[model samples]
Target: METRRDLRGILFVLVVFVGLAVIWRDLRYDFNFASDMHKAELGRRRETITQTVTSIALQTQIETQTELTTEIVKLSEDVSPAEKA
Candidate 1:
């Protein structure tokens, strides 16, 4: 029932379908790889943000402690003469 031309047409269609399938698979692989990379990058950014927040908190605490110490020394000086009398 098949002639040479019909057989050639079927072969061509099969080759095209296979090619398209391979292309689709490659695209899916690329999408998965890109998603994995983004997830890793996001995790690293979170870590960096946490470290930055901790550093800022420590600096603020150190500044507050220095301010308190200065106030205590000034108060002691003011009271020293009164106590002597």
Candidate 2:
């Protein structure tokens, strides 16, 4: 019974070590894969962000110009021809 208990303890420790090794290996691989993907996508992400910002800015400018033109037209209608002369 003592020998059997000693064998069980050794087996338990060995299994725990094997499990830890497997977990560490998987984590290392995942970290490396994610790092590589980020490096690959960095430029594409930057370009996409820049394009989106530029598009938003241009749309804002157009809307502002349209609003200003409408206001000018309204003001012109309120004024008389003599005001222009």
Candidate 3:
């Protein structure tokens, strides 16, 4: 009877240890998944910000070029009339 009791105790301890190990593994997996998802979201946001900045820079350059072209045309027209006279 004593030996039976000792065997039961050992079995119980082993079961508890197994349960704790499973719980720990599950928690670790969840933590890793969350960390990976956060990193992916951050990368996506960084790309979007970079694209928006580039688009704004291009728009400003085009506007400046347009303004310069208009000024050059006006100056050319003024010179043409003076030369015709």
Candidate 4:
């Protein structure tokens, strides 16, 4: 014994429920995608930090080698041939 007004009310409730389900699904997908992007960003930052540290260490080593070479050359100039005999 349902009237036309009751039928219309049921249809409205069904439409709202379907709309909410669609919105929930879309948000879940968006959250998962955002999480993946965050992980990738963290990995990239770690790599960049590692590369910068290695570059700084290599530059320091090279500078030390150059300084050592210069010091050896200066010392050699002071040596006399008589000292070698």
Candidate 5:
């Protein structure tokens, strides 16, 4: 009877250890998944910010070029009349 009781105790301890191991593995997997998702989100945000800055810079350059062209045309017209006189 004592030997049977010892066997049952050993079996119970083994089962408990297996359960704990499975729980630990599942928790580790969940943590890794969350970390990867966070990294991906950060990458997307950086790309969007870079694109917006580039677009703004291009727009400003175009506007400045247009203003300069208009001024040059006006100056040319003024000179043409004076030359004809």
Candidate 6:
């Protein structure tokens, strides 16, 4: 009867230890998940900023190109018709 009581005590302690380990693992998993989610959001924000800058740069290039084209047209008109022929 004494051995049986000792065995029961050991089993109860083992069960408690296993439960604690599971709880710790679950908490660790949640923390890692949150960290990864935050990193992803930051990456998305960076991408958006990069895209906006690129768009602005492209718009400026287009405006400069248009101005250059207009100047070329004006210079061509200034040339004599005989020179064009």
Best by lDDT: 6
Global Cα lDDT for candidate 1 = 0.60
lDDT of 3 at 59: 60
**lDDT (tens digit, per residue) of candidate 6 on 1-85:** 4464456556556655655555555456555764777656655654665565556556655665676688789999999999999
What ranges in model 5 sit over 4 Å off? 1-34, 81-85
Per-residue CA lDDT of model 4 for 1-85, tens digit only, reads 1354355446556555655555455456555664777656655654565555556556655665676687788878778878857
Candidate 2 residue runs with Cα over 4 Å from true position? 1-37
Cα error, residue 32 of model 3, in Å, equals 15
Cα shift from native, residue 85, model 6 (Å): 2.9
Scored by CA lDDT, what does every candidate get? 0.60, 0.61, 0.60, 0.59, 0.59, 0.61
Residues 1-85 of candidate 3: C-alpha lDDT, one tens digit per residue: 4465456556556655655555555456655764777656655654665565556556655665676688788888888666968
Q: What TM value does model 3 have?
A: 0.54
The residue-level lDDT of candidate 3 at 76 comes to 82
What is candidate 5's CA lDDT for residue 63?
60
Identify the superior model by lDDT, candidate 2 or candidate 6: 6
Question: Per-residue error at 36 for model 4, in Å?
Answer: 2.0
Pairs in steric clash, model 5: none
Candidate 3: RMSD to truth: 31.3
Q: Per-prediction TM-score, please?
A: 0.53, 0.53, 0.54, 0.55, 0.53, 0.55
TM-score of 1: 0.53
Regions of candidate 3 where Cα sits further than 4 Å from its true position: 1-34, 81-85
Clashing pairs in 1: none
